[model samples]
Target: MSWWHWLWESEWHGILLGRWMVAVLLLVMGLGLAGLLASLLSRFFYLSLGKTQEDITRRELHRLMRPAWLFAILLAVLYSTLHVLEFFHLSTRWVDWIHRLFQALVLLALGLLGSRLLAVAETILASRYQQANEPYKLQLVHPLFTLGRILLFVLMGFLVLETTLKVNVGPFFTTLGLGGLAVALAAQETLQHFFGALAIFADKPFQLGETIRLENGTVGTIEKIGLRSTQIRTLDGLLLIIPNKRLADSPLENLTRTPRRRVLFRIGLLYNTPETTLQALKSELEESLGQLPFTIEKPLICLTNFQDSALELTVVTFVDPFYRAGNSSTPLSFLEIQDQIAERILRTVRRHQPQTDFAFPTRTLYIQKSSTGLDALSEVSRSGK
Candidate 1:
C-alpha cells in the first residue's frame, strides 16, 4: 500500500489527528479569552491608579501583573499539551519533543515572570525605605537600588539562557569575561569617570546650589550635577565645566557648609598715634564691625603689630557666608572688606588724632661750605634765594 494511504487508513492516525486539531483550536480560543481579560484588567488598573501617582508605584504594579499573564499563558499551553499527548496515544518521539518544548516555555515564562515580580518587590521596598525615618537621606538609598537592579537583570538573563535555551553557561561566562576585559581596556577613562561620579554622589563633597572653590581659585555656584561633570556659574556670569574625576580627586572648599564665615584680617594705622589712641582705635574698630549688619559679634580686635612706620590692628569676626562676594549690600570679597575696614579706621583716626601724621620715607640734603662765612657770602652774592 502507498505510504499516504497507509497513514490515512490507520485508526490511531485518524483519532490523533482529529484530537490534535481540536486541541489547537481550544488553545487559540483560550489564549484569546485570556488576552482580552488581561487587557481589561490592566486598563482598569492603570486608569484607577492615575497619572499623579508615583512612577515607582505605577511601574511596580505593571511588573506585578506579569505573573498573571504568565499564568494565563501557562494554563493554555498545559491544557493543549495534555490533549495532544492523549490524542496521539502517547507516541514517544513527538511526545518527548512536545514535553521538552513545554518545559522550556515554562522555564522561560517563570524566569520572565519572576524577574518582573522581583522588580516590583524591589520598587516597593525601596519606596518604603525612602519613607522610613532613617539616619541617611533618600540620596543614600539610590545607589543600593541601582545595584539591585543591575544584579537582578544580570541574574535573570543568565537563567533564561541556561534553563530555557539550554546553553552551557561555563564557556559563555569565559567568553563574557574576555569580552568584558576588552571593553574595560577600551573604555578605561570612561569607566573611571563613571566611578568618580559615583564617589561624588556618595560622598557629597559639594551639593547642588552650594558655592565651591576649586583648587585653581574658581569660585562658583554649582548649577548642575551630572554623571560625568559638574556645571557651575561663576560670579563673573560665566559657566564652568569640571570633570567628575577631577572633582572627585581635587580638594574642594564648600563655602555653604559652614554656618558662619570667619574673617581674620588686619587694619593699619600711623605709628605716631599714642597707645591710648591705639587702644581706643581697636575698641572702636571692634564696635564698628559689630554695628555692620552681616558681621557677627563680639568682634575680637587687638593691637597686634607695632611696626616702625605703622600700627596694625587684628580684627577677627564671623559673617553670613551666603552674602555674595561682590554685591553692593555687604560684599564678601577680601578687598571690599579691607576697604570698608580701612575707611572705618581712617574715620576713627581723623576724629581722635587730628594732629597725628602718617609716616613716609625721607632723605636729608647736606651742603658743605668751604670757609663757612666766605662761601656763604659768595653763594648769597652769586645766586638768588
Candidate 2:
C-alpha cells in the first residue's frame, strides 16, 4: 500500500490515524477559539470599566487585561491537555503535576493583578490629593502602596508553597521568624528611621516646602520626605540629608507656619536731643510704618533706655506673611522690607528735623591747668593767711 493510504488506514493502540488526527485538529481549534473568546471578553470588560476613566488608566487596564487573557488561554490549554491525557490513558501523576503547576501559575497571576490594581488605586488617590491641594497626604501614597504590594506577593508565595508544592509552612514560619529577628538586628538603624518617618507623618511637626530650624541650629527648607530620611535645601543652596529619627526627636521650628515675621529695630539719637523731639519722631515713625504695605501689625516705637552716649529707641513691627522669605513671587524679602523701613524712618527724621543728629560714641574731657608759679604761690599764701 502507498504510505499516505497506510497512514490513513493505520490503527495505533486501538485508535485510527484519521481519528487521532481529527482529535488533534479539534484540540487545536478549541484552544484557538477559547483564546479568542477570552481576548474578546477581556477587552469588553476593560472597556466597560475604563469608559469614563483617564487615557492613562485605560492604557494600564489594557496592559493588565493582556495578562489576564493570557492566563485564561493557559487555563484552557491545561484543561484540554488533561482531557486528552485522560482519553489516551496517560499517567495520573502527570495530571496531578500539571494541575499543581497550573494552580501555582494562577496564584502568581493573581498577585500580579493585585499589584496592578493597587498601582491604579494609588494613581487615582494621588491625582485626587493633588487636585484638592493636600500634598502632604500624597506623600504617603508610594511607601504605603509599596508595602502593601510586598505583603500581597509574600502571601501569594506562601499560598503557592502550601497548596501547590504541598509544603508545610509551619516550620517555614518558625525559621522565618528567627531570620527576621536577625535581619531586624542588622537593620536597627534603618528600622528606627522607618518608624521615625511614620511618626513624622502622624505628628505633622513639619511638612514639605516648609522652612525649618533644627535643634542643632541647621536651617533649611524641607525638600522631600522619604522612607529613611528627609531632604533639606539650606539657605546657602546646599542639600542636607537628615536622618528621620534625629529629625523627629529634635526640636524643629517651622518658620513658614507663622502668620508674620517680627522685626526689632534699635535707633540711637544724640543724648542732647529733647524728649519732645523724640516723641515727635516716634509718632512720625509709627505713622510711616502704618502706611507701609508690608507691615501687618501696628508699630511700637518707644525710648527703651538711656544709654551712655545715645538715646536708645526701640521699634518693633511685623512684616506681612506674604513678604516673608521663600516667596519668590514677592519682590521684597523680610530683611529688605526692614531695611526699606529703616531708611524711610531715617529720611523722615532728616526731613522733619534737619538739626537732629544720629548718636555716636563721644567723650568730653575738662582740665584746669595749675596756674603759673607766681600765681600758684600767691593763691597758696592767701589761703594760709
The most accurate candidate by lDDT is 2
lDDT of 1 by residue, 154-243 (tens): 776677577656778999889999999999999889788878878987787877677888899988988876667778998798999878
Q: Which pairs clash in the backbone of model 2?
A: none
Best TM-score among the predictions, by candidate number: 2
Candidate 1 displacement at residue 161 in angstroms = 4.2
Q: Which stretches of candidate 2 lie over 4 Å from their true place?
A: 1-96, 216-218, 323-332, 349-354, 357-385
Per-residue alpha-carbon lDDT of model 2 for 1-385, expressed as tens digits?
Answer: 9998899789888666766776677568766686576567656765775533652365565565566566656666656655543546556787688778888988888887788777767877787777777767899998899999999999999999999999999998999999999999999999999999989989888888888878877778899999899999987899999899988888877878877888888877776666777778888889998888888889999888877777788889888756634657754655578788888778867865544667776655434456563322122111010
User: What lDDT score belongs to each candidate, Candidate 1 first?
Assistant: 0.66, 0.77
Candidate 2 lDDT for residue 121? 75
Give the root-mean-square deviation of each candidate in angstroms.
Answer: 9.8, 7.8
Off by over 4 Å in 1: 1-137, 140-151, 158-169, 185-212, 220-249, 270-277, 292-294, 306-310, 320-385
